[model samples]
Target: MYISAFPTFSFSKLIKRKKAQVFSDYFGYENTRFFYRGAYAIFYGVKALGLKPKDTVLVPAYHCGIEINAILKAGINVKFYDVTHELEVDIESIKSNIDEHTKAVFVIHYYGFPQEMVSLNKLCQTHGLKVIEDCAHGLFSFYKSKSLGAWGDISVFSFQKSLPTADGGAIVFNDRKEDCFITQKKPALLTTLRAYLLLYSEHIHMFKGFLFSVFNTLILKPSRFILKILKRGGSKVITANTNEFDAQYVSLGPSGITEKLIDSIDAHGIVVNRRRNYQHLLEGTKHIKNIKLLFNNLPVGVCPLFFPIRVNQRDLMQQYLSDHGIETFIFGKKLHNLLPKEQCPVAWAYSDELLCLPIHQDMNPGNIEYILKVLEDENCPLN
Candidate 1:
């Protein structure tokens, strides 16, 4: 059988019921202002405030390009900030970069791990800057008493990223109400249906690597031509590299079926399982030299997206894991080289060393052992 970085949902009956209840209960938003995608929230938020071109928005250098594209799309300038060795935002860098032109700061709770929001919030408050928390990896995860998305002037969550939803997103405001955009809601039905069908298709069995390779080569790759044709009408299509900001503009709140799937996810249980898997990986790798674990907290309030380990032979280690049926990832490969040399020295230095291992809810002890055995083998050479 193939092992993947994440698991496919069986779409059980109970999960469907819970999805709606949890969304209604947890996300208490009325029909104030809704959009099809999360990017529209950003667009509307900035547009409603009458923000103009040349205004700067601070963002972490270690973030997806979609966010930058969104800011750029709004005709706003983007300034990059550094992330700490712990993979949290470098607040000092943010402080140094803020100026009269800096209107907002976009912070991401990377890999479902909470950033030091308490401190970041205080800094933003003192600087009189608006905060936009990117909760793409942080849905259902909390920082302290409040959820990550709740801490900002405006927050965005990617249903496509964390939830079982095939495609959609939510943009929420804490204090200010945004003007409504004429969102095309019906068009999303086809995309969502396609995603759901793919989720349950027989092709899902090869999720380990072969499936991704096949999907990328066979379907996903060729779809660009079709998307180009659709784009002529000013419509955008979702792709693996779809920008975060653009996603926001088009993504809407979860659909009925997606809500049901998310509800069945056992959010609490998923966190518990992930924490257990994290502990197992930590315990198993404690004796391994030249490898550093990013998290300082053993059981962080943040639900981990994956267990990141920094090792010397990162590429070789990734290959080894994949060759043995254990999937690995370079979480922020695109982000490292984008920033200035001096801004994120630590992140850049360690970027090549970082490798994310599979630690999703479906992973178990046997899978963990198989991963560890490969790492512990003395014959495994560095590079």
Candidate 2:
């Protein structure tokens, strides 16, 4: 049972298409545009809000460097604010960093968990700073009965995180004071094909159904050997966040099929299953000895991307889980060089401590049981 860290793709969902809806569709932001990646969407959204390189934007100290890079590539000066070990945006830190040059603040809903948005919004409003909601891990997430993306001046989503797509992302303008960006042309054929192939391989490899098992034995195995023979087998794709933001590909939209893939998505079912799977992990791991669940109380309407836990020895635990075929990883272990570790000790501490387990919609109770069983086993890092 080789579980995946992220959701795997499948053709069956696309074939049973009904409504052409996405998580953002319910937000009804009128002004939404798709992009090749969430990082590109961030770049476009920040620029669209009339923020220039000379202006400063407050971002959390703990984050994937890609968003920081996006703001930097747009020439915006970023002021790193402290995020408490709770992963909530530190409001006082935001106040300390704000100045005349501060035009906006990027609020990341980390791991599909909402921040203190009502207060954060009020604070941003008082300062006249635009709130840029980074929903990279929060596609369908809601905070206090309202959508997480809806609380911001503008919001960006990474569809690939929540949906099974090759390459897709979006930027929704909630209160645009400046002109929004026009949709760019599609990416190169090779780029799109390579992205799909990477997803396809994961789908087949992770597929457990008898139908896919036969196909895997007959088709996938041979395809891997042939690709190896041709030296064409690789999972690398020119998607967002893998490298620095490229201006050349900045305007490019998602692949032609990405929209269709999203259209066919089981939006409601995915939400239900993910929440269910997450609850299973929460309840099953209650008796665990060493690990701490970051957000132990799963709030209603929050769409969790994973079950995150803080362990004393994250590397040891992660390796043990990987060795047992339970895919897991630490989040935000690599901070941007510009972020001072000395200034944000808590963020640095979390960087070394947090581990995220797979809790995607496809995972079942059995998978969750296996994960917990491995955690309690003698070879476990805690033991």
Question: On residues 1-383, what C-alpha lDDT tens digit does candidate 2 reach at each position?
Answer: 67878887766766646564774366653677888988888988888888976899999998878889988988899989998878899899999999999999998998899998999989998999999999989988888888878889999988877788867788888885336446588877656665676677667656654456677677767766665664455533365437466777888888878877877776778888899999998998888877688988789998999899888889988998999878885668898999975878988888888899999987888888988899889889877
**TM-score of candidate 2 on Cα atoms, chains taken together:** 0.91
Clashes of each: 17, 1
What's the TM-score of every candidate structure? 0.80, 0.91
Clashes of 1: 17
Best by lDDT: 2
The CA lDDT at 160 in model 1 is: 54
Q: Which lDDT tens digits does candidate 1 get at residues 80-163?
A: 988887778888788889888998888888778888888888988888888888877787677776767778887777655544
List candidate 1 segments past 4 Å from native. Answer: 17-22, 31-45, 48-50, 187-190, 201-256, 336-338, 379-383
- What Cα-based lDDT does every candidate model obtain? 0.66, 0.82
Model 2 clashing residue pairs (backbone): 53-75
